[model samples]
Target: MQRKGPDRRALETPRAAGLAGVVFALLLAATIVLMRLGIPEGVEAVGAGGFTDSARRDAVRAALALIPFAGIFFLWFLGAVRAHVGDVEDRFLATVLLGSGLVFTATMFGAAAAATAVLAVAHPAGSAPSLTAWDFGRHLAYTLMTDYAMRMAAVFVSSMSVIGKRMGVLPRWLTAVGAVTALLLLFVSSNVPWAELVFPAWSLLLSAHILLVSGRRRRVTLT
Candidate 1:
């Protein structure tokens, strides 16, 4: 009598991670947009006492509200990817991916916290925050977002690109795009306004790709 192997095909399921990635991409993009609009960087975009404007303050609060859910979906995406990779995943690259993603989430939260502090100080419905409070909170939030979170995002992109290349799962164009995204996050995002948008753009594209590929795989399997 011959021993039978477990049926791996039976374990196949819809790629929930890919869906989670899509959701994460959308949520993150919206959050970033709300934050930028709320706390405009240049003098032209926002003047003194900008925080006193209830509209901008509300935008910031909305962004803060979305951040935690975005982070949760991001973690879910990471875990799903790891589980999908299974035994074939490289330990080193996987470590970098997870570490960078974790740090990115943490730094984003830190930025949100800083923004919240600014909002707290600019309270009383029509009063400007103390100049010191506004300056410190704004700079801290901006620094955490542009400098720390984006740098970690760069690492995450690079690591994912490498892993996808090695796994032969990601297409050549996607890998190239990831490389460009990583570079943008690493250098341009800090100096250039709105450059950080590339990160979410890349994420959206990648997630879409994953979903398409998974659909193909399922079709082939069923056939």
Candidate 2:
């Protein structure tokens, strides 16, 4: 009886992860373009207290569409990570890491939707759309404060570092950077709001690294 070899699917995981990364990148790009067009006008109107009700509705709708893309990207991103880091330690760590990341990602959307729903109820139908500065501030804050931040901190600080070291995909330096970024995010949650933004940016970089490594088609070697 002959022993079975490693499944062909295992070899394809890297390529699949790379393709997913490309898709995720495109999604983020689209979301960013839409956001640039939507959020500024929306926030400006809210700040000036002059946005008409219809305009507010349209802007909110646009912004809402953009928000979901981030969630989708984050979720798919974890899938890509797990797909590439094909080892015991990497899998276990990625399981916890992805689980936490998704939890945070889901909560971010949940909170955003909740806030939007509350605002819709408060504003009601056909009422004057006079948004106060406080409303705008609160809305911005609501978008940022979430499990997304915590999970990012956890993943960047711990899981990615472990994956990077174990899999040898990303440079050790980048993994170290991820660890530092994660720690900064955890400690600077309130004082430095930048951590929230930094975490995702780092993730995108790491994702790009994974994509680069995986993009080339592998030559099969039966050993």
RMSD values for the candidates in order, in angstroms, are 2.8, 4.9
In TM-score terms, candidate 2 sits at 0.66
Which lDDT tens digits does candidate 2 get at residues 1-223? 1332445565566556555555554554454343333333233535533333455456556656766776776666666567656455545776777767776666656655644553454354545334553365345534554234455546535776777787666687788888877776666644543335555556656666665654443433342
Candidate 1, residues 57-154, lDDT tens digits: the string is 88999999999999999999887877776457779888899999999999999999999998888877668877787888888999999999999999
The 0-to-1 C-alpha lDDT of every candidate, in the order given, reads: 0.85, 0.56
True-structure lDDT of candidate 2: 0.56
- Model 2: runs farther than 4 Å from truth? 1-8, 22-59, 90-92, 118-153, 189-195, 216-223
Instruction: State in Å the error of residue 173, model 1.
Output: 0.3
Q: Candidate 1, 155: how far from true, in Å? A: 0.3
For model 2 the local lDDT of residue 147 reads 37
TM-score of 1: 0.92
